[model samples]
Target: MLTLYRPGTGWLHRMPAGPKLLLILSVVLVVSLLPAHWSTAAIAALVAIVGYTVSGLGPGLRGIRELGHQMFSLRWIMVITLVSQLIFMGPEPAVANTARVTAAIVLAALLSLTTRVTALLDAIERGLRPLERLGLDAARCALLLTVTISTIPVLGRRAAEVRDAQRARGARNNPQTFVIPFLIVALKHADELGDALTARGVR
Candidate 1:
């Protein structure tokens, strides 16, 4: 489920998946080319506000909060990015780079919040179909993208479940106690998914 989507009848939600995806891609391309950090920060805030407004306050806030939690989990990567930019490019560029990245992440989260997974996959497949002329498997690529996106939350929850089970067994709160069970659960999930796909005649 990825937990980002909020069911709604707002303009953003009602918008067709293909157009919305195109809009998101346009925004990402524009943001990537922008040089001013303040501009990117402003754009990010605006997009976030739009997400909240379209979500009807309650659901919007919940969606934003969920997205924020996901962002918080990436603290280490953000820190490393900022530090690297600061050391090599100076404070202004560091801030700009960080702002651009944050804006991109928020935009993506907004897209996921407003769009259904199935709709998103359809849009992705349609977009990729153009590449099928070059021998790419658009359907398979879309399915792969969907699987990757959906599996993230699944893996996160699996890790948490493993951690809690270890705690219940009076085990120490350490990576060593958690990693093996997590890996086992992951492998089991993969096997089941593979079997299901095979049964469905998916190559």
Candidate 2:
């Protein structure tokens, strides 16, 4: 699996996963509370940059690149969201919305850069242990998260392949050109993964 995790010994990487998750959540909450303005957006961007630096530059840039790939992969969804905001709230609000979403995404990318997927899965299981009383299977939940994390790069690559193929075939700026192929590839991946898990007695 092409994971966002980068092996490193920086302070950010050394920090416990639970605390890192909490810090990211806190930052998101704080940023969300700020009024939608250039100053607040700039501060959010700075925080994201600090997050990237603390995580280590090379890995952080990789994560950012992965995020950019995902953004382009799901351009149809983004376009729809952008158009809806423009129609309902005008262009200024749409711009602010896009900025806020982008800031949150960059912050998340930075967090994923420093934290390993396995560590994240372990943290999820630990956090959900208390919910076992409610019939939740913490291990299963963790495995699900692990699978989701592992599939991100795969989906991004598949989308890129589809886009390139469509462009070669003279398809232009159409949502179906990308979305249909991406969905098909995603479904195939899920089926293969499910079969592999079953073979391994994942139940």
The runs of at least 3 residues in candidate 2 whose Cα sits more than 4 Å from the true structure, single-residue gaps closed, are 33-44, 59-77, 144-158, 164-173, 196-203
Which pairs clash (backbone N, Cα, C closer than 3 Å) in model 2? none
lDDT of 2: 0.69
For candidate 2, write residues 8-83 as lDDT tens digits.
Answer: 7777778898888778777777776777665765776566565555555454475455456655754554466678
lDDT of each: 0.70, 0.69
Top candidate by TM-score: 2
Q: For residues 34-148, what per-residue lDDT tens digits would candidate 1 score against the true structure?
A: 8756566676556655555554424436656655654554444466678999999888778778767766666665677678888988988998999999999998898787665
Pull out the clashing pairs in model 1. none
Q: RMSD to native for every prediction?
A: 4.7, 3.8
